[model samples]
Target: MTEAAAPRTPGSPCWVSLLVHGMGTTQDFYADLFGWEFVPGPDQLGPYVRALIGGKEVAGIGQLPPDRHLQVAWTTYLASDDVDLTAEAVRSCGGTVAVGPLDAGESGEAGRMAIAADPGGAVFGIWEAAAHLGTALAGAPGTPVWNELVTRETSTVCKFYQTVFGYEAEAEVSADFDYQTLRLDGRPVASLHGVGHALPRDRGPHWMTYFEVADTDEAARRVVELGGQVLHPPRDGASGRVATVADPEGAAFAIVRSTTAG
Candidate 1:
């Protein structure tokens, strides 16, 4: 486990959040699966709550607006020194800023944020922290371990992020596979995978958030028992034993017992 007390580096994956239709049910499912406790968070977006483990913030869950029908998926927020500048950079790099570079809290103290999509339509967020620093704790079981962008190809999107966030892309040297590890200050922070035709038709290009678990198989089973579905059974991957699962609301995420976790 790790405590992120200081401000996160720019371009690093700093926070992950989920917007769902039923806030209470979604909270109950996650709390049961991850042993998380709920605390009220900034409500400017909607009914929102921060998930805590051992009194430290790990993630956020918010209730979606009733009239707006959107996917119930987890969003990975990248840290930015200046959100407005980052939003403009996204626009200049052929991406679209769908939401604001606006204040999040009632008194404009929580932080500034903007929702954006890449050239390939992969949605993400940019955050400039004030009082609310992104994710406070991670690397342990029930905390975010990784964020990956699964898209059709890595070359174009990798260049897009590199241009916008100054990320250094280190790609795998293989003709059969396409993947890139985005680095900031020489540390691997996020990754991009080119899956081509394997990309799900229903859900286009999007970011995938992985949460650490003590036992990947047990976590997969627990997901099934808690009114959720195991989309992919636990299996060995480059990182560790992992499984893809979806909440009752059909928002998909991965649980892994990462080999690199201390």
Candidate 2:
């Protein structure tokens, strides 16, 4: 299982947030779909709502600024000890800083954070946990179970992240699939997949957040019923039955029922 306890190690994906145009609608959709409860976040986290599962914070919803070209997407945040230092490391490793290494919440409420993109343009965040350590629940319904990057420039991204976060990757899945498991302290924390050939030519690099479900097929059906689109039908993979889906606003994500010890 992809069950994670507290005290996330640096380089591990510790939080996820959805940036959307219609904040209320998106919040309602996820709340209905995943049985999550929504609550206002810290004052400094303006317009950002906290998503709770079983009354514990598991995810976040932040409003996308109008007139911005940024698309609605789920961003995975990696645990970092020093946001400024990590941002510098990101630049040194060929990635670009998209946003701040600035304060996230009220004075010393949560830690600092920064948004950055890999060389391939896949966006992710780095969080320095203070009073607010991210996502306390995992490996269950309604919470993120795994984070993966699907990119065209796989080699460049792999090397950049390895340099920035000291990640150790093992490509034991298979040559044809080109899947590498990223590990921190010898434990699997995330993955990288080269899916350029499978995606549309115009599709750019992006990080995919996968949520664990009780049944992938049922979740796929419900996704369609809820006005979302199913990008990939349920199919058996080495990890478990999985399906790709997009919310009504076109933010893509995946659902999985793990059969292996992920």
Candidate 3:
């Protein structure tokens, strides 16, 4: 397992959590796939659970509110120094706050969090950590390796994130495809890509989280065996062998076997 550490920069993809049904089943699937262990969140946090890798926090899973009707999916949270200011920035840049500039815990042990969407309609979160500073492990088997914004509105989405997070375009992987790398402090932290003609049609703009796996083909195969669907067959990419998959409950995410392990 790679050493886990909290994100240090403002624009970093600090943490990710999934809101899904059948908490135990969802947890079991991921635990089997990624070797993650789940621990219940603080009592006041309500139905929240943390996913850990090698005793280090990696992700979170929580139950959906009984009254809400939303699809199950992973939501990435970007590190922020101030969630209120970031929420305002999201609004000023053409995004909407879907929920909270509220405390994540009774005494704010988790942090202040707010769910917001970019102009292109991708949902994400802003977190100002208090006792919890987000994911503690990365770049290892079952740990998050990358995050990408897969959207047709690449330009608009890119500009909105730039304004809100001080992100800069570092490289363009495909001019015709409108695929670009977004950098924070000159480091490639996430990617932005236009929807390809051959890619699956997403309902709208959204961020796709990628986790590292020991073997892409094996992981994809297990996803099917576990009753999840393989959306993209294992294939070579600029970074590594990759596959797109959806959990049984229909939350889609990607898995990668990095060309060069970090």
Candidate 4:
């Protein structure tokens, strides 16, 4: 694969998603983080959990079958009224279409999506909103307001997204990091990019969730107390401090308190 900067349609991101390992983890982790309340849906698709930050529904977590291999992780799901059309666009755009406009079951009707790499190895999900409009949470401390991509090839991924979601990448991202923003319907929705060499080998391609926190140090410590592991300590960044972590089952995610609103 040729290497180049994967530029995305410059703007802000739209929405993100939360993936989980098991049901209890899908419940317990965010409950401590966002003070979420449980809402029962059809007992079959399982319970739908809503996280409340400042007394408003900010994010959500739900259980999935073990085979999905998607433990508990946050994925920024961009809005889409037509997932099938988007999937087709993904194929025409030179990106690998991993999933579909297939049935995601009563999660309020979502067009399922998964894509890879930039200049072509980071994997993230695209949720074409149906009944669910996305996380109720905004830029509240301890809730998710932003989702960033850490990948290898940044440019190829940009083309894939532009073709898949009608997004564009920015030209500048500070020498410290590279970034590509996903835009849809002429509005910013999510982001794409390459950062660390952690992709391709350790975890394959995946979307990581970043939860808003007041203090990264304290939050990382709490993760340890709650059966989660602190994979990396809190580090300084333009977005304040962030710590890489995993749930009880070892599903990875991050916690951040940004300087600007996410």
Candidate 5:
């Protein structure tokens, strides 16, 4: 496993989180599926916990306010040096900032964060790390492996992210594929895909987080045993065998046995 001993590069995916209605069940489901242990976290937003693997933080899960109705999906957070400036860049680039460039946690130690949507309407988060440096461990089972934006087209949305985060976009050279990999400091950090009409009607455009697993097929099966649904069966992709699955509350994420996983 790779330990995140230093701060992640700006424009790189730093963390992922899920907010759900039932905290207990959500925690139990993930614990069983990924062998994650939970630790209490900032209560400023709500009852929240960070998921840990091998004693290092991997992700977070929080309980939403009872009266607030929000989509239950994993949010991918990109690292930033200044969240306020990034939020402004998002707005100036024709995107919308849905939540704060405000401090999280009572002492403002967790970090400053903002939730924003690109021009194509794919929602993602921006994080300026403070006491928390986002995901702390990777390249292991249960750790996040990739973050992808599934949208209608990549051109406009890619430009928005590039402007906001100073990301360099590299388009895939294929007649039938509309994919662009966003890079930071000469390394790929995230990706955007143009799915056209293949985008899910209910999900629309959104960011998808993929977690590494030892076996994609077994992980998909375990998801079913844990009361979740397999949205896509295990299949071979350029990266490796991968599958999409949703939690009991319908938060979708992918599991993959990456070709290059250590």
Candidate 6:
């Protein structure tokens, strides 16, 4: 995996959602680990879950319907002004348009979004924000604030993202980290880096979600207490203590608590 970068910018990285894993999990798994209150409601599609971070609606956790064979993992979303345009861009760039441009008005957010898996195989979200500016509790304990992608070919992922997202892809490799940050109008948007060999098919190329916590050790303990497994345990990542974990239902995700995150 590529080493992570210091924030290097004035604000926390702009991330929208961490959509990971598939049929093997229930929203309840994340609800307990991170101490969230779930609000499930029926949509035209069926029942969906929403939650509050800082008392403002920010993120969601949902299950694939019985017929959809989605893998268990999480992805981070970036806000877009127009998701339909983004979906069209994905098709033109050789990536698969996996989900919407479908309305998520039920998720306490207005507008449309579509999840796409890039040609390099990494999945990232493109969102059109409406009533929701994105996440409520950003860069804080128990919420997702920032993210990056680890791909086998940085150049391929970079090209695909730029072509699809209208980004100004950068070649400025970090001296401190083995990654490149995508920019839009000179603002950092997403990041890409080289990875080793192929990721397990079960663990496809996907964006990772970061949940802020006050204490990594405490969070790790809570994970086990709440019926989650520590896949990587607590280790020192560049920014802070990090761990790879799977909830009781088998959804894989990572956690970190950084003195520097917010």
Score candidate 3 by TM-score against the native: 0.94
Query: 155, model 3: CA deviation in Å?
Result: 1.2
Which tens-of-lDDT digit does each residue in 1-262 have in candidate 1? 7799899889989899999999999999999999999999798888999999999999999999999899889999999999999999999999999989899997769899999999999999999999988889878899998999999999999999999999999999999899999999899999999999999999999999999999999999999999999988999998999999999999999999998876
lDDT of the structure predicted as candidate 5: 0.93
Runs of candidate 6 exceeding 4 Å displacement: 1-28, 41-44, 106-109, 168-178
Quickly count the clashes in candidate 1: 0
Cα distance off (Å), candidate 6, residue 163: 2.4
Q: lDDT by residue for model 2 over 1-262, one digit each (tens)?
A: 3334466788999999988888888888888789889888654534889898877788999887787768788999999988899999999888899888888777756878889999888899999998788997878788898999988746778989899999998886556676778999899999998876675454578889999888899999988888899998999988899999999898999999888524
Taking every candidate in turn, the Cα RMSD to the unseen true structure, in Å, is: 0.8, 2.0, 1.7, 7.0, 0.8, 5.7
* Clash number by candidate, in order: 0, 0, 2, 32, 0, 8
After superposition of all CA atoms, the RMSD between model 6 and the true structure is 5.7
**Runs in model 1 with CA error above 4 Å?**
none
Candidate order (lDDT): 1, 5, 3, 2, 6, 4
Clashing pairs in 3: 4-136, 5-136
Q: Point out the higher-scoring one by lDDT: 4 or 5.
A: 5
Per-residue lDDT value at 227 in model 1: 98
| Cα-based RMSD of candidate 4 | 7.0
Instruction: Tell me how candidate 1 scores on lDDT.
Output: 0.94
Clashes of 3: 2
Model 1 vs truth, CA RMSD: 0.8
TM-score of model 6 (CA atoms): 0.80
In model 2, pairs of residues that clash are: none
Error of 3 at 85 (Å): 0.3
lDDT values of the candidates? 0.94, 0.85, 0.86, 0.59, 0.93, 0.64
**Can you tell me which runs of candidate 3 are displaced by over 4 Å?**
43-45, 171-175, 196-202
